[model samples]
Target: MPRPFVIDCALSFAVAVSTVLTSVIAGGQAEQSPPDWVGYLLLTVAAAFLVARRRFPPLVMVLTMLVSLLYFGLGFGTGAFTVAPALAVYTAITAKHRIAGSAGAAGYLAVVLLADRVGGQRDVSEGNVWMVIWILVIVVVGEVSRGRAEHLRAVAEQAARAELTRELEAQRRADQERLRIARELHDVLAHNISVISIQAGVAEHLMHRDPDKAHAAVATIRQVTKDVLVELRSILDVLRRVDEAGEIFPPSGVEGIERLAGRAAAGGIAVDLDVRGRASEVPADVGLVAYRVVQESLTNVIRHSRAAHASVVVNVDDTEVLVRVRDDGRGVPGDDVRAGNGIAGMTERVEAMSGTITAAPADGRGFVVEARLPLRRPEP
Candidate 1:
């Protein structure tokens, strides 16, 4: 059985035993008494009805009242039988049936007063006053119990909702972190691998015909690979200590565009970098986004555009930074340009920084990638 049912059974048995004992003791003291068995039967019936008080509080209260009135009418006892009905009233009130409980209490009290009047009992007003006081005490206690139970239930619901919110927030953060790591990996590896591939092909082609050219190509491959390894290590370090306070190295930003231009130059693309404003005044995160926009654009030019000459323009203002990369190459078909990872990655990064990126074929020839990043970073 459930614990509440067990407790109810125990309480019912205890009340029944106490009522029976009180009636037996009272019968011995009364001058004119009904049979002991009659008192025992009536009180037991009232107490037994209380076992279902939690499930049917109003009905139990009514039944106990009727049984108690019957006991009083039969002249078995008055005081002892009141205990079961009082407890039933308390249960009914605690069950949140306040109107019914109050009405039942009032009717039962009136009946008790009428019985006293018929019995010619003295000090009837004083006795009724004491009965009212007792009922009021039980009502107060029941109200307190009801309020406490409601408070505890509300607290439990709030705690559960808080826990669920915390879980969802944690999952959201994890998903965002995973996406950031994937974007970083793609951006870091794609450009360097393209440079290495082009350099290796150059070295192979010139190996027999021109020894010096071949050696320079080999050197370029070594340099590009070394740079890639350094960036890879930094990315790995970030992944390992994501919760740490400081970065492994200063983030690559607009200042690193010259090195990016050099790498593109080594890959047989001549890159002209033009700066129009005070690039140094830009915030680190915004600068990083600007650098990435240029980097990814140049990588796309090297890998897809097949352009010999390209130009990178960076114009900074007090509020925002504008970056554009245009290449003089056989540009991509509209569909091919629309469906590429480089553009998607650039768009995601720019949007995360509350910036915007656009990639499209130029008006006459080649392709262009443009990005605008706000200088004042938003509060995280």
Candidate 2:
């Protein structure tokens, strides 16, 4: 399933297959030359057992080393140079079962020397130095293979852990994105829907008493509801298919201020909009920040303010876009405004875009939210 596991499995399979094929060839040689086939057959069986050496190292070593002794007993000198048992020793050592490997090594040396003494019909003093040299080579290879396998396994484990961390981080980000979309939908549609619902009920109650006046109120409700649905769908479409091309638009720029004014007018909050300098000079992201600042400010006015009037001013200089929203209302409730993350969130967005926001109750009356956003994208 994962890369490291897949690679390890393939490598282990290859090693096992290779060991079996090599053992069959070495086993055939023993059968052809030796008179006592029993000892040679035992050596062949031991070598074949090496295929599962890693999974059952200590057992494989004991069984294979005993077979090696029997082959030596039957006068089979030197040869296969039995790479299989050497592999078994390597497996045992890598698994940190070095004591088992050491025991196998000691037993192998004893058998080789004893065989030479018995078969040659000679003294122990006349034993071949080459047998000792071969044993040393086996030990060296075993140590090297053990170290390599350990290093490879450690690296594989580290890689798997890193991959898992990345996957978890991606999932966390996806969850956060979903929450962002939900918050936007709730903030934008909920307030407007509340107003429309109340106004619709009022119009229904006055239908017979004041038909013409009631008709105007009903029309306003329809217009307000339609506008909310259109914008709601626009926001949802952006959330549902962020990956799709052509879904993007210039959001929260000069056009956004006009839309904000229109929405406030519909909600019975008279707004005066003032624009200065080049309106189109702001970057798209900065424009979006400007839009959000105005949007949140107006939304707060409708929901929290007692005053029926607000003023919006946009100043686009050479380097920055400054937006100011002032309301002639009993200044914003400190605790509610602070507890609501809207203002703080607006500041965060501005800072992320390399900008700043300041909000305070005006000197004599009402409240003001002013934001200065850089026209250029921040350096990466």
Candidate 3:
């Protein structure tokens, strides 16, 4: 049997033995019939009801109430507190049947008080008043226990919700970090690789006729390769990072765009790079986006435009950074720019900084990529 059932069995035996002794003392003093076998049976049944208190607390409350009333009416003794009814009321109240438990307690008290008056004992004894107080104390004690249990449950639920929020926030930050890395890698590799590809083709073609020019082209290829390696290493360092606020990123901005334009100009293209406003005032993140836009636009010119000339204009203001790149090659593949790493990647970067970008055919010739990057990034 369960431990509680075993405990209840022991309690029932003790209460039965105690009631017999109390009733015998009352028979001599109060002129009441002492508890015989019939009274012993009633006491045993009332205490036995305590065994099922946990499973059916309300039912135990009702059953114990009825049995106690019947026993008290028989003029036996419970001069001290009755243990069984009090236990049943405690179980019911603590088990969350607070109202039913109160009713049971009230009904038991009223019935016992009525039984005393009906049995011609007009004066209520002090012990009887203490018994009534003890039953109310059990009710208050049970409510306090239930209140504590409820508080613990509420605290546990709040802790679980807080843990879940932390996990979701972590996941969101991880996704944003991965996306930043991807955009960086794409911008770095696409521009430099296009330069290297153009230089390789130049070196191959000029190898037979112009040996000096071919060697210079090969030299450009080597430099571009080294630049790509340095950038890739920075990204690797970011990946190996162990915590936040200590990430490694490429040291790139508008200041680096001049070198970027120089590299593109060396790849057999006439390029004019212009900055009309204070370039130093741009925020680091916005500067990075501007650099990427210029880089991607120039890469498209080198790979697709087939034009010998390109113009890159950067106009920085207090509110925004404007980038306009135009080439005198074929305007674009089509009127509407298709999605790719070229224009589409630039679009993603510009929009992420709460900026706007437009890539389409220019007025008469060439393709133009124009972007306006805000000074501040939007809130996440």
Q: In terms of TM-score, which candidate is strongest?
A: 1
Quote model 3's TM-score.
Answer: 0.84
Q: Give the CA lDDT, 0 to 100, for residue 87 in model 2.
A: 60
What C-alpha lDDT do the candidate models reach, one value each? Answer: 0.85, 0.71, 0.83
- For model 2, residues 1-380, the per-residue Cα lDDT tens digits are 56644553554455445544554555556433442446446655666666556678899877777766666565554354344566667668777887778778777777667666666645334334655666667677777877888899999999999999999999999976876666566556655665566467658877999987678778888877777776676786776765545434336467668877876776668999998888876677677778878888887777677668999999999988889999989986565566776787677677878888888887788899999988886678
lDDT of 3 at 282: 82
Q: Candidate 1: what lDDT?
A: 0.85
Error of 3 at 377 (Å): 4.5
Over 4 Å off, model 1: 30-35, 118-120, 242-250, 377-380
The 10-residue segment with the lowest total lDDT in model 2 = 30-39
What would the C-alpha RMSD of candidate 3 be, to one decimal place?
A: 4.0
Provide backbone clash counts, one per model.
0, 1, 0
Off by over 4 Å in 3: 1-32, 79-81, 242-250, 331-338, 341-344, 377-380
Error of 2 at 55 (Å): 10
How many angstroms is residue 62 displaced in model 2 relative to the true structure, after the best TM-score fit? 11
TM-score of each: 0.90, 0.65, 0.84
Error of 1 at 342 (Å): 2.5
Ranking by TM-score: 1, 3, 2
Candidate 2, residue 70: how far the Cα is off, in Å:
14
